[model samples]
Target: MNEVLIITGACGVGKTATARVWAKAKQGVAIETDYFTEWIYDDSLERFTREEEKLVANLSLVTAKEYLAQKMPVAIEGVWSPYGLSLLHSGLKKKAKNAKLKFVWLYCEISENHRRDELRVSENQMKQRVDIVSQQLQSYHWENYVHHIDTTYLTLPETLAAIESK
Candidate 1:
């Protein structure tokens, strides 16, 4: 089976940090999903249609397939909703015929106050992202999956170790 790792959580929850360590320790490539949109959209003014978002999402899956073809473990880290993961899970299932694909969700419980303080992105950026995410969450069902790691109090290393255990 092909091995696929997904490291996900809310903003400022250290998902990226844990993913980096897990990828390096496991000798897998770490792909940041956020970069896909950032790279494709040079200007925020140019709004992405729903079709465009799906297209970019497909591109990410295609890239993941390419990595899986190399038979190397791969880590995908970012703020992914259930819909996003559904797309990714389907893509991997289709592409990885003889490989194992694993999905691990890093469920972070970041307090509103802490999120405001510990965020690495600027205040404006955080607000913008959270706003969009808030809107998206209204229609998302977040309880379908059972595999998750609660990262409310764990440090980065602890979180990485927890995910690595299973």
Candidate 2:
């Protein structure tokens, strides 16, 4: 059966990279919600407002539903909380009820996140905003449903193995 994998985490936790790699390996489609949000606000908007996040989330869900309709597996990568993912989960159930849905959360130590953030080259203002948001969203709690991966000390191969083991 086709599946929908929602990959979420704080900023700099490698959600996009991991999702892309996984999708390619599995011959699935990867949707980066940040790309959708960027297309919506490609101007001087330095940060995503809650309203913008909701809009992008909706668009991402729509895209995922479309892919699943085509009998294709999909991976959605984003910095999403449980609340945000709950929205996607409900939408997917309503739109593609038969698709298996999985929620994966990638986590790493604050120091590692900060290091990755510093290594990223982006506008200084954007970097600052991402830093603030990442710090605020460093921890997440969901009861028994989330596939949590602590990527603090894992190499790329190790991380992939951990995710695939799930």
Candidate 3:
């Protein structure tokens, strides 16, 4: 069946990498919402606000729907909130009801997250608590569609296996 993989997490959690691999495997497109978010990023804010999420989700919904309409699987990686997913999920379902919707929420130890952040280019460096956003997400009650992945020590291939096997 055609699928839409929503790969979400905080900085340094490997969402982008995993989504890319997954998309390639399925011969699909990987939509990274970071591009959309970056366009409106204000240094004053800590992370994305609800209004920002709405804008990002709206555009992402349109993109995902377009790919799914072509009967291609899609993987979307982003730092998304549960509320944003609720909106995107509904919007996607309305347009592509038969597609399997899978949510992959990647997480890691704070220290590990920091270590990964250190490896990133200076332009993409984390300026604040990677833990805060990720932790806040962990606190929420995730539904059945969501899959939690603890990537404390896993390599990229191992991480890919974990996601695909699930």
Candidate 4:
């Protein structure tokens, strides 16, 4: 059966790298929502807005549906909240009855998150938006569809193993 893995978390939680690695290993498609934003807006991430984010998310879902329609596994990486994930899950279920849907929420301590953000190329923007990240952290609500992974001290391989085990 085909599968759609939605890798979601806060900004610096390594969703992009993890999803890319997982997709590569599984020979599947890795859909990074940021690329959609870049393509549609032709601007930097700092200029991204809520409307643009929603558009990118919807486009990612569409891309995932297309891949599942072709019987391929797809991994989507983004900063998706519970509501957004529910929509993607429902949409995928309606699009492909037999396809498996998995939601992985990667997390780390606030300090670790800040450290990672600092090392990022977009650190300036990330620093300026710390409040937004804090809000995202506080707003996340878990449900049965989600598998949470705390990656504070784990290496990439270890984190991958944990996800696989889940």
Each model's total of backbone clashes: 4, 0, 0, 0
Question: TM-score for every candidate vs. truth?
Answer: 0.74, 0.83, 0.91, 0.83
TM-score of 4: 0.83
Better of 2 and 3 by TM-score: 3
lDDT of each: 0.64, 0.77, 0.85, 0.77
Let me know the TM-score candidate 1 reaches against the reference structure.
0.74
Among residues 3 or more apart in sequence or in different chains, the pairs in candidate 2 whose N, CA or C atoms overlap within 3 Å are none
Candidate 3 accuracy as lDDT = 0.85
Which lDDT tens digits does candidate 3 get at residues 79-141? Answer: 888888888789888987888888888999888888899999988887475767777877887
lDDT of 4 by residue, 1-166 (tens): 8877888777677888898888888889899886665454322324345576666667887898888777778999877767667777777778767887788999888788888888878623466444465566567677797998998899888988998888
Model 4 misplaced stretches (Cα beyond 4 Å) = 38-54, 122-125
Candidate 1 local lDDT, 10-117, one digit each (tens): 555566777777778877777887786665444353334556556656877787788877876777876666666777777777777665665666554335425743
Model 1 misplacement above 4 A: 39-50, 112-125, 131-139, 143-146
Check candidate 4 and list the clashing pairs: none
Candidates 3 and 4 compared: the better one by TM-score is: 3
* Residue-level lDDT for 57 in candidate 2: 77
| Range of the 10 consecutive residues with the lowest summed lDDT in candidate 4 | 38-47
Position 31, candidate 3: lDDT: 97
- Which clashing pairs does model 3 show? none
